[model samples]
Target: MTMKRYPIAIALAVAGSFAGCWTGGVIQLFSCDDPCYGLDPYECDDPCATCEGECLPPPLLGYDDPILLWTGEAAEEAAVPECPPEAPGLVFDGYGGFEADHVCPECRCTEPSCELPGGLTGSASAACDGTTPTSFDAPAGWSGACTAPAAVGSGELGSLLIQAPTVSGCAPANDAGAAPPELPAPWTVRARGCSGEAGVHTCREPGKMCVAAPVPRPTGFAMCVRYLRPGAPECPAEYPELREIYREFDDTRSCTPCGCGPLEGSACTALVSAYEDEGCSALLGAETVTLAGPKCVAGPELRIESMEARWIKDEPGTCAATGGVAVGEATPKGATFFCCQSDEVIAVP
Candidate 1:
């Protein structure tokens, strides 16, 4: 009685059985980065200026006018890098990565180092508590419009062709009778671009991209001006709340002879080229910054701008954007991320 050969169903049963035995992950969700993996895996949380989980007002830019933005003759008409290439060169999904997977939020132990059969070494990674928790593959089986957290800011996504913001007093008039008044070397990003709930839109071409909201007149910025003039009524910097995210490419991160890749940087420009009632703004990791007002002035428009941040081991939750601005602290109430801090590089002017 028996050569009972049932085919498709038998094959399906065997395949399903083995599928369970085969253990491998198609995606990874990791956080808690090591400098060895790359620079701290989070955008610099400036602007928010939080501490102890409480929100503090953002710092003001320190300069008064464009005239002070440079030194010698150069500073007088301080030039920027030829307004950068129009096409944001190439577009790269500048998402930072997880260092390893065997992650333990308790011990902060990440995935273990990996070596393939021959020699291709690999590592495992996973998500951490405080970070935004991006998955290698967008979370599986997500439902509803609200299922996924939205990007921080608004403004169209992908290859943004933004015009340089125009600063009237910042520029000198054209040679007698030529043009009315020319704009400055390069335009800065807009608060509109960098100021919302959705994250941001960045250039695919990776380099070092950073913009001073309302164009910082100098370093240690204390103000973002609408139009710095001799005697005209003043307008505070468009949006003192700003963000400049710089990232590098794959091969670029291979530098520095370390096991980890090169710490690449990226910059996206949303140059505003309009005048009269048109201004721009962007937000960086400086979670808290001074508001645009009578007393608000930036220290310097130029800064070394580093994105790496160091939060106390115990205060992971404090760094999040939920509790207002936390600068070197651990709590907050009616606002965004509170108590974030970073060191300033230098003043451009």
Candidate 2:
């Protein structure tokens, strides 16, 4: 005969009324199609198994390490390296396009020149201080030779006045004809930097991170290091490394303005003689004096007929040269910091 089976709850309730408390080994309400059915939930390989606790999120892709930067520079004539190709996942992370239009020209000076003392006069005043002076002057083209002029009127030969010499021409020779030297080539040099991809395995090695540059290249280049991020603070928390790289320059380079100083070391002295005759053959009195004098000397009371003068000592002076020093300077435009995992430092170009 066939026996009918009921649900576990109904069968358990009927069995409980007829018998005392039942201790059961196992019970099944229905059969499951799953191969894992009735097994420990932890041992189940089922895709629909209910998990017991909280789930976790996945980690980010790529290396999580900070990126370090490098810089380089080149002259107008030399070749500067381009970003290396051997380092895969490398990027043209930063650029330092360069320019230098400032220049300092050679300093120069012209020879110093001076004029001779020319004005000579006689004064009727006994003090010889050029008061009430009269022309005892030599001829316009006189070259310090002795000459006799018309006899002085009574009392007109009491004193003589001589004028000092002056400076005539002096200056910087460079300013004579040329405009300033042509400014240095604009944007003459250039610079660029590179860094590896974050967490990139290939970028982890030194020198391997960069390689020989390609052709059609610039004049000069260098390998350098910099902070990966631009505009970072003076010392960034992540990158405390310090370095200097230039994108441009601040150039005020120039020669000092040309100039000349006061005259020095010039001197002249002359001898003046008074004569009783027009030919200046007989002298009444004579005095030796310098350009610093309006010197007066006691003259014989006799009527003065003529006068003559001759230079005793003559020496030209010089002017001190001033200015002409090279001034101003050229400096890197901005700063970019660099950080390293160790104490390794990259040389600047």
Candidate 3:
């Protein structure tokens, strides 16, 4: 059988396949006849099939520089670090964990208002039962001063009609810019300093090499990962193991509900009197009534020529307030990952 010859490049690759020591920056092949048996088939006419001692592992892949990271509050701004030559600098990756404080303003109500009694009438029917009625109403906005509205014969005024005051204008008070501002931005961080070397190396087959590893990992870093897509994805062949996660986020924080209560505690009253003369000189009878209006009462048996009404008591009311609190949370967005390579450290000779 005719033997086939392989090229020098192929021979060198095959010769470097077996175990050998790392010197300076290159792999030094040993002759097959040597006790260590480096498996160089071309070194000796007859190649040794086996080695007497354990073989050295190949070199490992490591990043030329360390991966950088920076993080802070969503509202705070942070500065990024410069990268090594020929490598990408710190970039805005995404957001990670988050924190927030949300709140609402207090609520309140304005004071209640009221108007005194107006428009009084008289009836010849006893008990003011709306029979043979006559207009004895005081002028609009009339005070307690004496005035003759109408004259009545002896024993003609049997009853009187008085309408209660008007109550109104109770509303919720305004807050000092109680509404909240717009939502804040998501948490952020800068990372990924540089990458490891690429392409085939001269390291021994099945042997790991030692190179410089980034000193201490960045603070709060889940782990070192190679990024391929915007989201978590399969790691490169160099870094096979990995964990998926996000670097940025979407904020949903907000405030609770708030409002005011019903108005209450308001009241009003007035005193009314009938006089025997138009000048209101001789007092015939008098009574006090509330603003529930159209109140009727029996008149004095004597004749009434005039009448008078004076506001006696008026009480203002207030409303209670409710609900003003903080609530809600934020969600994570923009995915990424953590990946790694070999951890072996080989001593250089």
Candidate 4:
């Protein structure tokens, strides 16, 4: 009976070994190797362990203090050092330096120049004092020199004593100095219109008008007249006659004289005849005259003399008479005749 039991035991062991092999094969076929198994277990690299939260350190600290190393309330507190408080009347001097009295000098931060005080010198000292002092020798204890206690009854002497430099050979000579040599008078070149003659004449100062008046026989004559500036008082004596005509846009516009012309009515006609004798015939003729008001009635007879050697039918009259007409019918007479019709000659009829 013992022999039989031993054989059964061996068979049972064999069957158990086969069952273990089958179980191991089935597990290997269904399960896969973990991709993140041997790698650093920081963030999720394994698809299967993504939702399990098995990763040791999270990718982001998530609201944790950046400067702190530990997580979950174990981080050391980080306190910034406090800066020094600013003092009154003190400011930064822009070079990492500070000054209590921040008022900069005229040349600010630069060494002061050796300029003489204002009331002590005139413009001559400007060129001499435009540099800094290379060597300065002050009296001993000059820092406290003016701050010393005064004598009991002595009046206050001024704080500092300033002395001008002693200059030699700087005296100006009285007789040696002579008035500036007189300058030659300035003259302007002008052309004589009648004979086409050119000559130079003395010119006036600037802003003066060079008026060239018409000479008696087509010659030229020039005179300088001071130009009237704006807002100047009327000077009729200075400009007795119109020396020049200017088209200036100012109050001087009213000062210009009226031009000679054949104006309206009998009064204007008579004025034009007296003032402008040369233009009388054209002005009073029927072709030009159109007397609207009062109808210009003829006046006293006027005698005229012809300057031309020959005369035409409708030639204009000049000199002492105005508007002459021819008497006889259409025939060229050797001599010219005067036409009479009150004062004005109507035509050669």
How do all models score by TM-score?
0.12, 0.40, 0.40, 0.10
What candidate 4 gets wrong by more than 4 Å, as runs, is 1-24, 29-108, 120-349
Q: Over the stretch 1-349, how does candidate 4's per-residue lDDT look in tens digits?
A: 0001122123332221221112322311111243333335432122222111010111121111001010111111232111112111111110101111211111111111111111111111223232331111223322211111111111211111122211122122221234322221111111111111111111222222112222221112212122324332232332222222211111111111111222112211111011012322322212111112112212222111110011112112111211112112221112211111111111110
Please provide the root mean square deviation of candidate 4 (C-alpha atoms, Å). Answer: 54.7
Ranking by TM-score: 2, 3, 1, 4
**Clashing residue pairs in candidate 4 (N, C-alpha, C atoms within 3 angstroms):** none
lDDT of 1 by residue, 24-72 (tens): 4322111222111222324432221212111112223432211111111
* lDDT at residue 186 of model 3 (Cα atoms): 38
Q: Give Cα-based local distance difference scores for all models.
A: 0.19, 0.45, 0.51, 0.18
lDDT of 3 by residue, 214-270 (tens): 333333332243465455556555455554446655566755444566757767787
What is the alpha-carbon RMSD of candidate 1 to the true structure?
46.5
How far does residue 131 in candidate 4 sit from its true spot (Å)? 36
Residues 251-308 of candidate 2 have per-residue lDDT tens digits of 6666566556775776656666666777778876776666464455544333455666
lDDT head-to-head 2 vs 4, winner: 2
